[model samples]
Target: MAVQDLLRQRFFPHMWCPGCGHGTVLNSLLRAVLELGLSKNEIVMTSGIGCSARISGYVDFHSLHTLHGRALAFATGVKLSKPELTLLVPMGDGDALAIGGNHFIHAARRNIDITAIVMNNRIYGMTGGQFSPLSGIGVKATTAPYSTIDNNFDVVELATAAGATFVARSTTYHARECTELIKKAILHKGFSVVEILSQCPTHFGRKNREGDAGQMLENYKKITAKRGSKALEENPGLIGRGIFVEKEKPEYCQEYEKTIALAMKGAGR
Candidate 1:
């Protein structure tokens, strides 16, 4: 289907701030869905309260706009009840790694067949410029007037350690690559986590003096190297992008079915 067909056009004049990287992420996600030939009925998108969560409102797919940091929990229920449907849960840094953090780790640990998209813009854009879990130390936010002293969680590492079967990282600057990564994540049969380093020009940029959106995109290009590249080897400070992990594992829903069958047979039902 065409990308436009997947959109809820009446909701146009999107809510995201001008130059916000979340828009790019939405665009990339739409293209990925279209490229995968996924029908609206075949996919379900869930989101928690935040700027990133607004994506659910824009897409025409079956969607659940749930409470702060609970999108994954709601999605887990949906996937378990209806294993035939594809689940996509998109969340902001705070929405994904802060209040919703427990759900995020457990979901990954379960190896459920869900696509978790963490749009790490570093600040809580929807609720003022508050520093988030992914906002590394030294970054400025409204809650961190003197800069944050707290270290940030490396999303790729966190997801990997939590037992996600598919983990990848990309940035809004690498939009086409982000789309490709999302497509692959959707096709993976087990838990998949894709962290997109989205930029929040209004909150994160203004607070940190990170220049305008264009400059922020350029910064992403400068600061990130492809996975396994010599540049990454030479510059330890630079972040690496691209798929970090992909391997087979027993999916939660499928395993649950086996357990149910065993119970039924033992009961002689």
Candidate 2:
């Protein structure tokens, strides 16, 4: 399928700021979908309120633009009702982990057949650059003019510990790697989480002096190493990119079917 066929062309001239990495993420995601040969009707994309959430509006899939921090919740219901459809929930860092933190963890715990994409730009981009939960200590933002004293959540660790059967991390700088990871995450049978460290050059970049979009992309290249690589072993601070977890597990919807069968037997139906 042509990538253009998967997009809602009427919504082009996307709203994301120039140099924002979210657009790159959108491109990678679409490419992954195309490579997987998924029809528009077979996929569902849900998103919450944020710059990243706007993605649902551009894709020609069954889309749901739900309340802030609730994309996963709505997606859970959709997957439960229609288990055959592929569920894709793309969310901002703050949208997924700040207000939506509870839902994020529980969704992983349930191991439902949903792919949760976290666009981790590390700031609340649409809300005037507030410091988000993923915004690490010493980062400046509108709400943290003196720099944030709070720590950031390690998304890969959080997702893995929360019981997501498939977990991975990548950055916009590594576009091909990001696309491959998304493809793997979507194909995984149980709950999957892929954290893509996107760049918000307008907000996060200016506030933290992270340089322009290109420079930030370069920084990502310098800071991240492929998982299990010798560079990562030598320099522990480098964020590792690649699938962190991929294992078979009891998927929620299939287990739910079993529960229903047991209930029917009990009722002599």
Candidate 3:
């Protein structure tokens, strides 16, 4: 647990640019929140406005730094005002799918328990490059300087069709399989989306020349080994990274605690 005492070194100089895969996704998300021992006041780390929302100002614990794409609506009001906080929502890709695409599809269709680490890096590296919504459908940024002819929003198939129980995709040159798919999307209960695939390499590596940072981690290790053997020969169809989705619904704080116990037992007093 000595990872510089779980970082927040007074926000020590991390604005994320040097061949930035958002600092290998903030060092595999502080080693998957210190290997899930949790507690640093139970973790919050929300974010928004670009450069991966400056990683909630270097993460000491209980961060916000909001309002670019509204960081899953301020991480759904800090997990519905502390429903046992562990809500780590790091964003990017134009602050989560182009101006927070309807708050990332209504916080994954209200399955919002929140793990959402989406450093997609497909352009728009802090308001200069532009063209995001995942940016791969042709690619050339600075408002698609002759390439991106639309069509590119596959953020784990739009967070498993916006009902996100758990969704995965990893990159940043596989930083330990993107920290074990963000440590199984923080012990999955409900809304969990990973979708990292980072590496801007200074505005998508000088517009696809893709040179330094070891040739963009050797073209992301040959595009994640040909997209991980075509997602194991397309088993269950088109699943790209590991753990494409895991189910078990009923989360948004256990269905908002059963609708506040049926509105306090129908106000019987």
Per-residue CA lDDT of model 3 for 1-269, tens digit only, reads: 76567788977768777778888888898988888778888888878887888888887788889889897898788789888888888888778877888888888898878898888878877777887767767778777788887788888778888788888887888799889889989988878988888888787888877887768877776655434575456554433667777998888777888889988995868
Off by over 4 Å in 2: 266-269
Candidate 3: count the clashes.
0
Question: Which candidate gets the maximum lDDT versus the true structure?
Answer: 2
Q: Each candidate: what lDDT?
A: 0.94, 0.96, 0.81
Cα error, candidate 2, residue 110 (Å): 0.6
Q: Per-residue lDDT for 1-269 in model 1, tens only?
A: 57778899999989888999999998999999998888889999999998899999999999999999999999999999999999999899999999999999999999999999999999999889999989999998999999999999999999999999999999999999999999999999999999999988898999899999999999999999999999999999999999999999999999999999888885853
TM-score of each: 0.98, 0.98, 0.37
Summing lDDT over every window of 10 consecutive residues in candidate 3, give the lowest-scoring window.
230-239
Ranking by TM-score: 2, 1, 3
The lDDT-based order of candidates, best leading, equals 2, 1, 3
Give the Cα RMSD of candidate 2: 0.9
The per-candidate count of clashes, in order, stands at: 0, 0, 0
